[model samples]
Structures are given as C-alpha cells and as structure tokens.
Target: MPLRLPPLPALRFFEAAGRHQSFKLAAAELNVTPSAVSHGIVGLEEALGVELFVREPRGISLTATGADYLSYVSEAFSLIAIGTQRLPNHRANRPIALSCAPTFASRWLLPRLPLFRARWPKVNVTVDTSHRQVGFPVDGFDFAIRLSRAPVAGSAWTRLFGEQLVPVCSPGYLESLRDVQGTPLLSNATLIHVNAASEDWQTWLEATGAEHVDPDAGLRVDTIQLAFEAASMGLGVALGRRPLVNRDLESGALVQAAFNTVNSATAYWLVSAENADRRPELLDFRQWILAEAAQFSCDTSVDAAAAQ
Candidate 1:
C-alpha cells in the first residue's frame, strides 16, 4: 500500500527524452543507443503504471503525466547541480553574479563572452546591467565592472583597461560631415551623448575648438556603446572609445573621422569585496580574467603585424 519511485536511470532517460523530444538525440547525449533509452523509459512507465510518452516514428511527445513528472525531475537535477558545484576546488556552486554598465557589457564583454564560457562553463554567470553606481560589497556581487573617471574609493580595485575617445561615424555618415577643408565636422546628424559622462563631449569640443557648436544639443544616450550604435546606424556622430569600439571600427560598422584621440583618465576597473579573496572561485576567476587580459595583449600584437 506504499507508492514506489522510478529508478534514477529511468528518470534521467525520461528527462533527456522530454527535453529533446527525440529518443535518438537523448541517446546521443547520454552516450547510449536509442533503443536503450526507449527501454529505460518503458521500465519507468511500467513502474509508475502510466503512459509517459506518445510514441511515434518521427519522434516522441510527453504525455500529461510525463510532463508533470518531468518538472519534478528537472528541479531535482538543478539541486544536484548546486550540490555538486559546492565541491572543493570549484568556483562557488552558486551563480557568479556580476554587475556592469549595460553599455560596457553589450559593446565589449558580450562579444568575448564565448571565450569565457569555453574556459569556465561551470561558473554560472548572472549579469546585472545598470547605469547607477552600485555599492560593491553591499550589493552582493562577486566583481564589479565600473565605468568611472576616478578609481573606486575605499575598495580593492584593479584597472582592466585604459580608454581613449575618438570622433567616429559610419563611412557614409562621415562623408556627409566632411567639409571643403576635408575637416570632418559634426554639422550633420545628431551628436549622440552618453549622459553619464558629461565631460566627454565637452572635452572633444574643446580639443577640436568647435566653439560654434553646442556640445549638449544632440541625442543623449546613457552608455558609450549606444553612442557608437547610433553613429553606426547613421543616427549621428559619436565620441567612440578605443577599448569599446575598436572591434566595431575594424569590422567597418564605424569609421574614425579623425586620428585625433584624447586620452581619458577614466577607464573600466574590476572591483570586489574585501573578503572576496577568501573564496577559491573568486580567486580562480580573478586569475582567469587576468590571463585573458594577457592573451588580449598578445593578440593585439599579432593583429598589428597583420594590418601591415
């Protein structure tokens, strides 16, 4: 008069099949044959005394009971994942929550995320994209990618990269902005501004001596990448940052209007809680990220040579 539970193997097989809706693909993932997967599912169904799947030659479909049971199994597997992640020598089995400005994530890191995943797939990444200043230790983030002109005060900070701002637009957009003296002017299109960096546009205006132009009068965006994207789409001219839009320039999505680049003291920095060093995952991640930075240096050298 007691209820019975399906074996782990059978439940796993069912979960795989339910996920892919194909016994053969599930078999491939599990390194078993389609027939073996089917047999396991059959055993599971018999044990539960219910039909779990709608069998067909093309593929399998989950029945009502199968769907309901699959949800429970999926949750159980998730807990197992969390448990196994807690094992020693691993980054905390908990998700590695990261915070960064949306612009930085989209323009720079998102493009290179595949490399990060390939190197550390087990480290669960949860990104918080906000433009506001987040208190690093109080906000519960493993690391913070901050866009600032000054170093984060009262925190352990490391400079990730330096930034240089240049005037850029699409090739066609630049052509339109070109004058009789071949000076690329900002008379055409809307000047995109990252409202967060009020000094950026003013600095460019001062360096170029475009006194007649209003630095604040244009489309305002909160992030540098948005400015780049607007320029790319011919929305207007933008002050492109070297580290953020270098790849975009190389890819022809954007074109530098002039070689005049001003060094901006502000740059992205990596910061973490004071106690972050105590965790193995945090330490491993820091080392891995630093290694990635080294690789970028080598790659840039190779690219420079290839450009010649």
Candidate 2:
C-alpha cells in the first residue's frame, strides 16, 4: 500500500494557477503554455476527485474545495521554501526578490534604492515592476509595496505613508491659468486624469469643495506617474499624490496648481509573507524602509504646520 498523490508538476501548476486565478498568467510564470496549465489543473482535479476551479467565461475562480486545498498546498510550499533556504548550500544564496507596483517603484523605491545598496553592498536586490497583486511564496517574491486603504491582502502589512492629493502643473504652466492678477483659474486648466475608477479629480474636488475644474473633463491616463509627466511637459494640471509626487515637487518640475491638499484614505504599505522576516536581508530592508517612512511622515507634518 503506497500513499497516492498527484504528480509534483501538476501540483505546482495547480498552486500557481490558483494563486494567479488565470491559466495564461500561471503559464507565463511557469514558462509553459496556457493549455498546459489548463490541462494540468484538470488532471489535478481528476486525481483529487474534486473540481478545484469554477471556470467562467471571463475568468476562473476557486470552488470551496479548491480554496481549502489551495491553503494546504500553499502552506506546504512555504514550509518547503523555509526548509530549502536553511540548507547550508542554499542559505542567503538567492537574490531578494521584491514585487512592487510600477508607479511606486519609479517614483519612490528606485530613488531610495541607492541608499539601501550603499548600506548593504552584498545584498542582491531584484525588483519586479509588473502591476499585479502577487502571492507570497508561490509568486517567488520576498516583499511587496502595496498602495491601498484596506489591509494588504494575503500578507502582513506595515503602513508607509498616507497620500495628500494636490493639483499640480509645471511652474511655467501655472502662469497660464491666471487672469493677469495671478488669480487662480481652475477652469482654465485641463485635468490630467490617472483614473482607475478612483476618479481622483472628482475626489479632490469633492474633498476640497472646489468647483471651477470639471473632474470629468481632462486628459485621461492610467497611472499617477504618467499624469505627472504630462503635467511636467506643460500639458495640464495633474492631481499629484504626495510622497509619490514629493520628488517632482522638490525638483521644481511641478508646482501646485492649487494650495489645497486633500487627505486620502489610501496609503503605501510594506507587505510580506508571514515568514519573510526570518531572512536577514529582508529584515534589513524592512528596518531601512520603516525609518524612511517615519522621516517622510515627520517632513509632511512640518510642511503642514508651515502651511498653516
């Protein structure tokens, strides 16, 4: 009598597929075809005598049985990862892979990365900038930086900084929105929208009680970085998110179109697997980032006080 189990490869496919919820994305991660991932999942389901995924026209979702199995499978993989890393030949031998959002990566992380490198010359850092909410061990990332109002899903999270939404444009562009009296003219400016159903312009307007600019009318884009870039080119006034926009504002490449700063519920957070803190490099990175966040918070407070 032997303990029956599915093929290891099929199990891997199931785990990745469940984590990604898309066979195509799982295939890309595993360097295989989507059909292969789909087939492997089918085979896995057959072996377990239970349907793992509820396949729908738009996408697939886990059944109750599938979700339960996924938890067990994911935990097992995490345990295996911990065990393998503790091996004498494998310990501290891999690059610290970080999955971070592209906008945050460019605007905040990359700029401060040099200091981390300077502090820890031996630590190898690999950054994945794809705009996807990745899983922990399954996704092969040690840490992530997420921007959300709610707690970071699927991982432990530490608050980084809250956002201040301020309308901004280039210094030269600011002069164009005046009636020769240097009086503010919000309607005269185009609103560069980095809209993700968030309707940032509308949020800012409602928060500040400003009525001149039409939130619906603007140059629409998808990312905060792009909107600011367009604004820097003297195109229009973009809603600048603080911390992300702090660098550009400091550089004088962008100026506040209005003096109002609307506080947002969302904040940047450092997210990680439950066991990720065991790694020395990860611990060091966490410490450095926390310190940076604290300093930024202090600076923001000082700026606010000065404005008042």
Candidate 3:
C-alpha cells in the first residue's frame, strides 16, 4: 500500500498563488504563464474536489478551505527548508530576512542591529522597511515587526513595547518661542506631522488638555523618521514616540516641549510564521529582541520614576 499525495507541481503553484493572493504573481515567481498557473490550480481543485480561490475584479482571494489548506502546506514547506538548512554539509550563510515598518526600522532597530551582529557573529540579518503587511512564508520573510493594536493574523506575535507620544522640537526651536509656558504657545508653534501615525497633534493636544492648538495645521511627512528629522532641523514640533526618540533626547538633538506624554493604543509586535520557533536562528533573534525590549522597558521605567 502506498500513501496518496497531491501533485507536486499543483501543490507548488497553489502555495505560491495562495501566498501572493494572485495567480499572476505566482506565475511570475514560478516562471510560468498566468494561464498555466490558472490551469494548474484548476487541476488541483478538480483533484481535491474543492475550489481554493474566489476570483474577483481586483484580484483573487483564498476561499476558507484554501486558507486552511495553505497553512498546512506552508508549514510543511518551512519544515522541509529548515531540515535542508540543518544538513551536515550546509553552510550557515543564509541571512534572516526581516520585514519591519519604515519608521521603526530607521529610528529604533537600525541603531541596535550592530549589537545583534556583535553577539551573533555567524548569523546574518537583512531588513526590509515598508508599511505593507507581510504574508509570512510566502513572502519569504523570517519575521516581521508590525505596529498594531493587537497581533496580526496567522502568525505568532510578541509585544515589543507600547508607544508614548510627546511633543518634541529642537532646542533652538524651543528657545525661539516667545512664551514656552504660555497656553498660546502650542497654538502659535509650528507642528510637524507623521502622516501614517494615529498619535497626531490632535490626540496629544486632547490628552494634555491643550485644545487651543490647531491639530491640522502643520507640515505632514510620510514617515516618523522624516518628522523627527524636520524637528531636529528646527523645522517644527513633532509628536515623537518615546522609545524612538530616546536617543535623540539624550543627545540633545531634540527636547520635550512639554511634560505631557500619552500612551497610544498601538504597540510594536514581533510576528513570525507558525513554525518559526522550530528554527534556531529565528528563536535566537526572538529571544535576543525580547530581552532587549525588556531591558528598554526597565530603563524607561527608571527614567520615568526619576522624572517624577
């Protein structure tokens, strides 16, 4: 007696399509035409006696059944890759591919990456910074760092840190203010805005009871890094995430315009595929990052206590 299995080619095509949510992109990846990918999926559906995808005007989406099947297939593929990499003759040269938010990457992670490299000399790391949501194994990422109210679906998530928004500006900018302690100061001062973040001047102003400030009046930038840069250059006051701006504050490049810091609902989350824990390198990175985050939290608590 022999065990039955899905056709390898069909399985490969289906996995790629399900991962990308598009037959066209899957076809490009598999080096086949879209029609071929479609045909392969049809053959797979017929063989399995189930439709895997729902066709749409904009793109294709996995059916409920397809999504379930993809999880198993993705796990199997990941395990196989892990096994292959662990072979005796194999070299440990593969870099851990991490997808992270642009602002977090530029402001926080990049500054600390050298520490990781110093600790794990043999391990390599590659980072891709984007605001787009990652699709796990299909996207070929080992891990991702996301800023969300909660964990993302279909992957393990570890809460890295909560965000505290504070109004920050260059020392020169603060010195130039006519009345730093005046209620009219916020209303009169120029504001710098990070377009994607929800913790804007309006939220900060409302939290700090500084309703006189016009929330919408400011220069808007696409990333927090840009807003920080603008603020550092004395362009305007930007709402800074405490963890991201800690180093700048310490270096005197920026100063808090006020003592009003409000915690945001969203936090940084570390996300990875279902089988990520089974991989040694992923586990190492996870442990290391969590430890670093814990230390950062402790340091922040001490700083707050001292300030109080």
Candidate 4:
C-alpha cells in the first residue's frame, strides 16, 4: 500500500504556530518572515480541510477541532523525530556513536567536543554514558573509551591515558577538619570510595607501605561522580582523577588533600572491533583523540619539569 503522509515542512509550520500561538513568534524561531508562516499555515489548513487557528486582533487561538488535531500532530512529530534519530545513517553526513564513562564524558570529552564539531560539521556524533563497561556490537556502540588494567583478552586496545589518583575534599571540609584534633583529621570524616575500583584503598595502602590503614571504611560509592559529589558536600575525602578534578581544584570547589599521588597500572583505552576501526568516522575520531592525547602528554611533562 502507498503511504500517504502530510508534507513535513507544512506540518512543521503548523506545529510551531500552534505551539507558540503566534505566527510572528513562530516565524522568528523558524527564521522566516510572518508572511511565510501565514502561507505555510494556510497551505496546511487547505490540505487538511479544516481551519487550525481562529484569527484575532489580540492573537490567534486554536479552534475546537484545531486543539484536538494539534495534539495528534504534535505526537506524530515527536514519534517521527525519535524514528529518524535512531535510524542508521539518518544524520546524513556523519553517523558515529561512542560510549564512555559518565564522568569522563562530562569532564573530558564534552569540553573538547566543539572542536570536533567545528572540524567536521557534517559528521553527527552521539555520546552515550555507560559508566566504563560496554559490549560493542551487542550494545550498538561503534567505539568505547574503556578503563581496564590492560587490553581485553580478545579485543584490541589503544592506550589513551594512565591512571593518576589523588585525594580531594571540599573547601569547607578542609576548613572544618583543620582545627579539629583527633586520630588525624582524615579519620574523623567519611572516606568516599568507588566500588568499581574495589581494591583501590588496599592498592594505595600497599603502594604507600601503609598497610595498617583499614581498606574497608567510610562511605562506599559506586561511581566516580557520586564520590566527587560526596567530597564536594564535605561528607568525606575522595580519591579523584587528577585530570577530571583539575577544573574543580582550580575553581576552589575541591582541594587536594596531599601532593603525593599514585599512578595505577590500569589505564583508559580506546577500544573497538576490527570493522569499527576501519570506519571513516572512527578513523577521524581516533586521529583527533590521539592528537589531543599528545598535547595532554606534553602539557603534563612541562608541568612536571617546571615543578622540579
């Protein structure tokens, strides 16, 4: 059977007009003149065989039929949008989807995303927050920023950055703990830990040769963001990623508890299957990421050199 659908452009015009209740406002939003909006609405109404809006000096109002039909039109538009969004290659010029940890997405990738957009305006980028674990083809993901000790058994991995862990607490937490005398200020507050990095406390203790420090203590958090929030709320000390928390530190929302930090064996990696690795969009993304990583390495090197 032949599918009969209304003209998308005309439907869009009516939807906008109905939503704003003003042709002028709709025209402004659509970047068209009032005459264009009026013409589009008239065309839509003519095709539908019903008046959509009652003209008035004060403003326009929906007719009884217009109000009922408007609901269906709005709903139809929303469904069309969802269908188009998820359709493969619907974005036209660029269709790429990458998944990564939420904290990484917000703290690292989002700030740098504009550069990618400027460079490849036609390429559409979709970012999904998976909190560090994803299953590739099964998950409908093109690529993923994975955090692991090393390469997965059967998967190829490109090392992106090393893990650098440091203690952080809110400014208020530090001020409150500063004057208190007890079994060390740290013991008085709850320590926030990421459950994914289950052995983090033990690993830190072993590396620092402070084995006596209890590994099981304080508030346990399941995600990096939650740990950060807890620390920011003056709830406890949190082990934070230096790069991720750099902004908060600079802004004085969070402060480092100690200068010393441990570099863990685990690293953040860019992982994808064989087919995905060869994709043009993936290739472009990989090149962009590697370039940014190189810059970050150089910056860190210079900082370390200067500190000496």
Clashes of each: 0, 0, 0, 0
Q: Which candidate number maximizes lDDT?
A: 2
The lDDT for every candidate, in the order shown, is: 0.75, 0.85, 0.83, 0.75
- In terms of TM-score, the best-performing candidate is 2
- Superior by TM-score: candidate 2 or candidate 3: 2
Model 2 weakest 10-residue run by lDDT: 84-93
Predicted candidate 3, C-alpha RMSD? 4.4
Q: Write down the worst ten-residue block by lDDT for model 3.
A: 177-186
Model 3 misplaced regions, further than 4 Å: 1-92, 180-184
Candidate 2: misplaced stretches above 4 Å? 197-199
Instruction: Please rank every candidate by TM-score, starting with the best.
Output: 2, 3, 4, 1
Residue lDDT tens for model 2, 22-132 = 898889888899999999989888888999999999999999999999999888887887676566766566788888878788888889989999999999889999756
Q: What stretches of model 1 exceed 4 Å from their correct place?
A: 1-91, 180-183, 187-190, 208-213, 294-308
TM-score of 2: 0.91
* Candidates 3 and 4 compared by lDDT, better number: 3
Model 4 residue 163 CA deviation (Å) reads 1.5
